[model samples]
Target: MTTLFYRKIYAMKTADSTEFYVVRHGQTAANLQARIQGQQDTLLDETGELQVNCLAEFLKDAKFDIVYVSDLKRTRATAAAIMQYHPDTPVFFTPELREWHLGALEGRSFAELNAAYPLLMQQIRQSSFDAAPPEGESMLQFQERINRFMEKIASEHPNQKILLVTHGGVLQRIFNLAVGVVGSGNLRPLCHNASLSVFQRRNAQWQLAVWNNTSFMHLTSANDTITL
Candidate 1:
């Protein structure tokens, strides 16, 4: 196990700053297998379980005002660890925050995907955020859904510290939204298991305080790629 010293995301919360502690869930069985989990629910694997302990220890004292997670086992497991410390914190799930449905590609690996469906794979490789896999929703559809979710949260829980436990795919969308990132085929950091990203909105502008943070991963494998 690796060890990392973490600083509080928001050392001190202010009345005007709305802070979000957005986290991608820990490692999963699918991740180890190099398969796409998509919206298919899977619980945390053995390593993921230990990763949760490190995550919880890092966040136990943030005292988030509320917690939100996608209605998926991996994320739920991570959120559960935090709840053990913040026993009184309210935690809930929403389907919209789940992973981007990978459709027919679910369970398939990138290596086979490249060989089996070269054209489709090309589209994916091109960063076709608006393109969808067979039987999947397009990136446009996914982004719109995420936008609505963000709006609802900001409106409902203004000026509060919030914890969002969700998939790496959704986290990508949230990160893109946060950075006004547009277009395809751009370089973006990989989201890691049990990683955290911090965001704040001021004057209607979103600012990324952190990104793809695996500071806590010092407790677990640093190479587990929670791919989007």
Candidate 2:
């Protein structure tokens, strides 16, 4: 339950400006079971639902202009909880925002994957930018996918506060891109479930405003007995 928040000040505001409030979806069955999930769509468990509701309550005052979510079930559910209050606000579903395609690794427990392909798993953990897991997407491929999705968002909404519900891998890539950090060597830790990471656009550049603000975690814990 550590909350991290950062902000940058900028004077310029463009007519096509966009503020991205990125959120990782609530915990899924895969998360609780320590599975690779990847692009697989899983429904939110009871705790996951509560987590999203808490996040919705925390973000209710922010008044986002638009809500965007991955087409994946977990992310869609998370976005639904937030958009419930602002029924008038439009919600956009994008498949490009989906999690890294885990390929054959999808829906398998991490332990099982490692046990079956220990060396390959080791290579991935050691930095497998070019190497793809057995029928899985490479780290480089994931980065490219995230970049395309981000560029689309930039083009679609330039000057508006947007709420995005996506996955941990996608957000990590975005953090790296915004900070001018690239490559699989220096990946940021995965975002927490239902956590918010804010980014601001200024002078045609994206700046990281915050990284993994878990205020929602506190709010969720206040009313729920579950621990993640």
TM-score for all models, in order of appearance: 0.88, 0.89
Candidate 1's C-alpha runs over 4 A off are 1-8, 219-228
Q: lDDT score of model 1?
A: 0.77
User: What lDDT tens digits, residue by residue, belong to model 1 across residues 66-106?
Assistant: 88899888999899887899988898899989988879988
Worst 10 residues of 2 by lDDT: 5-14
lDDT of 2 at 159: 79
The parts of candidate 2 lying over 4 Å away from their true place are 6-17, 220-224
Q: Go through the candidates in order and give the clash count of each.
A: 1, 7
lDDT of each: 0.77, 0.79
Over the stretch 152-196, how does candidate 2's per-residue lDDT look in tens digits? 777777777888899998898888778877655655565778888
TM-score of 2: 0.89
